[model samples]
Target: MLTKRLFSSSSASPNLFKIGSILKQTRTFTDADVLGYSELTHDANPLHFDAECAKDAGFNDRLVPGMLVASLFPRIIAAHFPGAIYVSQTLHFKLPVYIGEEIIAEVQATSIRRMKNKYIAKLSTKCIKCNGPLVIDGEATAMLPSLVIEPPNLASASS
Candidate 1:
């Protein structure tokens, strides 16, 4: 079951994040996506690169590599919290994904605490298909700087 949460807030200066903050992104896996990942990782596993081989091996179809699916997790984190440094992540592969399947990655900020000079956020993360089957589930810990830094003006630097 996919339950979408609604948030309404009007704050002039928003904090970097808050507990319960959520981010979700969905992407449809493509043949190009699988091939590109395989080329990048040098993982030519028959299941990922060769559809005929995959079918022969008994999978319903060519399966998307687990890491390829899990990679979407970081996009959600970065979208919500840029410059947040990932300290650790634990991922569990729950289901096989096939080409052209849309998968959604959702992450929620579970805990935010000050650890020394930096703030650490613990996130509850999960990826699911459009039909609600779990593909990946795990937790991630990220360190957010206590102070946000504004980027320097490139024009000034170039002059």
Candidate 2:
């Protein structure tokens, strides 16, 4: 099952997200995605490009690069948080993801910390194959933009 959610920057605020808040997005990696990623990153591993080599490596088809699959977490976070900056991430590849398989990327706010002018969010991130198994498990830290409220304009009020 594929699901998409749109979040607008105008509606995004660090204060709006709380502990246990969750976001999920789904995607099916295709040949074009792999090709583009490979071209952009120069990741020309045979397992990702050669089906026979993939079969020899015990996978059914060309394997999608683990980093490419893990990238969904940042994409989801950036979309939802707008000005959020990624601080760190940890990943564990438990299973192989093949091309054309639908995968769900999920991020949950595990903790939220306020640092004066910034909000730091610790998130639990994971990717699962549709009706299959967990392919990647990870954690990430992001710094969300602080909410800035403009002081009421005294000149306008006086005017």
Candidate 3:
């Protein structure tokens, strides 16, 4: 017989490498939030803001596009992960995120590898809410200026 329990599958971990991640938490994904980002990033993708366009495209409503969720890296890096530069990111969408739906996005370090002067952080990401489990799972690699070489939080200094 098989028993069912939460977190029985993949083990979720935290990101740790250059030392500045102080910490963070889950957050909601909002239409207004995404729309504002679209304007700032100058990426006026209809899927993020145009509800009608999204509906026509087969979404229940204005779905938060993939790229938008991927953008969470920036917010994560800025908010709590204070010393990393996103070098590569890959996310597999399991479902669509409708406008106004709250999403829990997380990036936990799975492992770390050394590369030149910087380091690579292998992370596991997920976006989950009332709809059930995560709608997406992602892996990301970031190149960071190590405090081991410079100072603490130096990654955010350039911004």
Candidate 4:
């Protein structure tokens, strides 16, 4: 389990999330996306870059990298849970995600625990092809920053 501090601040309250709280995002991976990801990450897998190779491997089209698909989870988490630390994640790649296929990434909070000044949440994560099949299944743990609100100064108000 790898832990990463995703952000630092007190912009969001840990109370924003609760058991069964859910978030969903939809995306369609394109040729440009595949090329750019390959260029940046040097993943250059034949299944991702070569259609013939992918076909030979039993897929209809060039496959998207599993990491690329899994990356959506972090994006969803960070956007909805600002200032939350992405403590750890576990992923299982279940099926090939082809280029140009629309997929939906979803995260649901399953549990929340308070530890002193922060809240730790356990989340269920998954991605599914649009009207098709499940592509990824996973879990994530995050540390949400606690918001601090100071009481108004009574002496100043009295003056």
Candidate 5:
């Protein structure tokens, strides 16, 4: 639960890949995104929608839905290492996320179950500028592809 260090990606790589560490994807929050998420999820909590209410609530502005922001982790992990099998994910919403705020999600390979052929990635998603702790802290399991290969196209098979 620390903000510093933690970089190992896999046990397989002596150069960079090792168990118990990972990297991150950075993103900025926008007002439209907050509003849209509120609209879609019906999470009209004043802290997330009403500017005045949010001001009163002690937030600089309306906050973002934790769930909507959290949904990006999978995409980030996938983007970092394409074709890796994602097996598990668990998120704990820590603090509120504000619109116009940028966040960086850090993912680490905590351990691996060799017999099961699966890897565990412990993740910390947060906004560095705000001085607040991670907005979301979680763990994910993914099966990293040992080699790249194309899967048969299901469209052609069905035809």
Candidate 6:
């Protein structure tokens, strides 16, 4: 069975990588975002930047790049799990996200296991808009930083 849950940023404790831990955030994909990403990635697809082309393609407005929509997952991880290293990610684009729509990106810890000295977090991720359509579905694996603490050096402190 598959479980689906939506979580808020404050719902999870930072640095505590526990199973079922969820983190989420929302961002509006604006024209500026699309333009900036296009300039950065050199992606000049008309569906993303040209409104007329998007309309011709049967979309209401210019479409946001799938990668741009996927980028929010990392921010959710960074905000709720500082020091976590993103090891891998997979995304499935479900629907096109139009420019100027606010979408929510959510990441939930589906499994947590200790590998060697660090914990590896397997997360279920997705992006949904205000109207309840999922724009992207994905999973990500993050290696949580070590929690080991070093012993205090009393000899050095005294010297």
| Model 2: per-residue Cα lDDT over 1-159, one tens digit each | 232222324345533566656677788999999999999999899999999999998989999999999999888777666677999999999999999999988888777777656777788999999996999998999987742312222211000
Q: If both were scored by lDDT, which would come out higher, candidate 1 or candidate 2?
A: 2
lDDT of 4 by residue, 92-148 (tens): 999998888899988887777777667787889999998968899999998877422
Each model's lDDT = 0.71, 0.78, 0.59, 0.75, 0.59, 0.74
Which of the two candidates, 2 or 4, achieves a greater TM-score against the reference?
2
Q: Rank the candidates by TM-score, best first.
A: 2, 4, 6, 1, 5, 3
The C-alpha stretches of model 4 lying farther than 4 A from their native spots are: 1-15, 146-159
RMSD values for the candidates in order, in angstroms, are 9.1, 11.7, 10.0, 10.7, 9.4, 10.6
Give the Å shift of residue 118 in candidate 3. 4.5
Residue runs of model 3 more than 4 Å from their true location after superposition: 1-24, 42-45, 49-52, 114-118, 144-159
Write down the worst ten-residue block by lDDT for model 4.
150-159
Clashing pairs in 4: none
Instruction: Name the best candidate (by TM-score).
Output: 2
Query: Tens digits of per-residue lDDT for model 5 on 69-144?
Result: 7766666556554677777678887777777777766665565443233333444433243455677877666665
Q: Give the TM-score of candidate 1.
A: 0.76
Pairwise lDDT winner, candidates 5 and 6: 6
Prediction 5 TM-score vs. true: 0.64
Each model's TM-score, in the order given? 0.76, 0.81, 0.63, 0.80, 0.64, 0.78
Top lDDT hit: 2
Candidate 1 lDDT score at position 13: 28
- lDDT, candidate 5, at 152: 26
Residue lDDT tens for model 1, 1-159: 332232323441243356666667788889998889988999989888777888888777899888888777666565455577888889998888899888888777787777666677787889899999998999998776642322322111000
